[model samples]
Target: MGLNGQIPRCEHIDRCPVVEHGPPECRACLALGQSWTWLLVCLSCGWVACSDDSRGGHAKAHYQETDHPVVAALEPSSTWRWCYVHRRNV
Candidate 1:
């Protein structure tokens, strides 16, 4: 997702995560002693997970398990989100 325009909401969109900046790091990364190129945050539950680029792929797994369609990049500088169901920027 590009960093411009109004971000669309996914079915699982919850509250504005703007209050808290993206998580400092991917929890799964630390837990697995793995490095993550990108982090993904579950908007509905605030679950910190890793992107598919990482070995864990925890974020994508979380979506598959929880049906949580909404996830934003956990990088502090990233301002876009992705909808797993629609496979597009949200």
Candidate 2:
């Protein structure tokens, strides 16, 4: 199945960058070699980032800066997705 088939249609999809790029780069956090503890999928732009960066505090930063609220796992092995506002896996 494709990512669309695996993930649900989030209202924020239209604003997410991951919708176009597939995933987002975490240059600030990835440089640290920190194992991502969670995936912060941007509710505004669907940017996927490692939670190790404060559970995607950067992603949260996107929300705080933009007022969006949604995210998903960027884990390569897992097939789970979630919504920040709902606080439940989708």
Candidate 3:
């Protein structure tokens, strides 16, 4: 929820094609022989990529390229979800 009484919403959540279980590392970084800070799973298409904190920022790139709206943390214990369109956690 925001400062106002409105409930938070993410329109793209329903558009997710699949929800992926992330790999041990960013496959993109590994293919490039680079390191990454963390991983994000694209909810729209189940693409796994490096987080923005990582050098590659591949997760963001996936969103930019695909116009995908949401991604979630790939960590096993995580429940965090990010909305690329809204630029906020949803």
Candidate 4:
């Protein structure tokens, strides 16, 4: 629930830019020679980053830097979307 006791909807999804795909791996992790556990694709801008559970938490970092709230799991078998601001699956 949100402050108004209503479920918060993801505001970024509708305005997300359409991207065919993102990079194969986290660019930040690659530049730093670090390993990432999983990848997430930012729906707002299609930035590929590491999950928060990863060493660098690059996905969360990207959100902090860009205010892009929604991200979809970039795993082959996953079809889930998450809302960073609402802290829930969208």
lDDT of each: 0.75, 0.57, 0.85, 0.87
Sort by lDDT, best first.
4, 3, 1, 2
- The candidate, 1 or 2, that scores higher on lDDT is 1
Q: Please provide, for model 2 over 1-90, each residue's C-alpha lDDT reduced to its tens digit, 9 standing for 90 to 100.
A: 348567455554445554532455665467776555555555445565666346445665565566766666665566565556555565
What is the C-alpha lDDT profile of model 1 across 8-55, one tens digit per residue?
555444543543434667776797788887777888678888888888
Q: Best by lDDT, which number? A: 4
Between candidates 2 and 4, which one is better according to TM-score?
4
Q: lDDT score, residue 54, model 2?
A: 68
On TM-score, the leading prediction is 3
Model 3 C-alpha lDDT per residue in residues 20-88, reported as the tens digit of each score: 555667888999999998888888777889999999999999989999889998877998999989898
At residue 16, candidate 4 shows an lDDT of 79
Which residue pairs come into collision in candidate 3?
none
Ranking by TM-score: 3, 4, 1, 2
Better of 3 and 4 by lDDT: 4
Clashes of 3: 0
Error of 3 at 24 (Å): 3.2
Among all windows of 10 consecutive residues in model 2, the one with the lowest summed lDDT is 13-22
User: What C-alpha RMSD separates each model from the true structure?
Assistant: 5.2, 7.1, 2.4, 3.2
Looking at model 4, residue 67 earns an lDDT score of 91
User: Please, what are the lDDT tens digits per residue for candidate 4 over residues 1-90?
Assistant: 588797766776767787755767999999999999989998877889999999999999999999988889997789799888879887
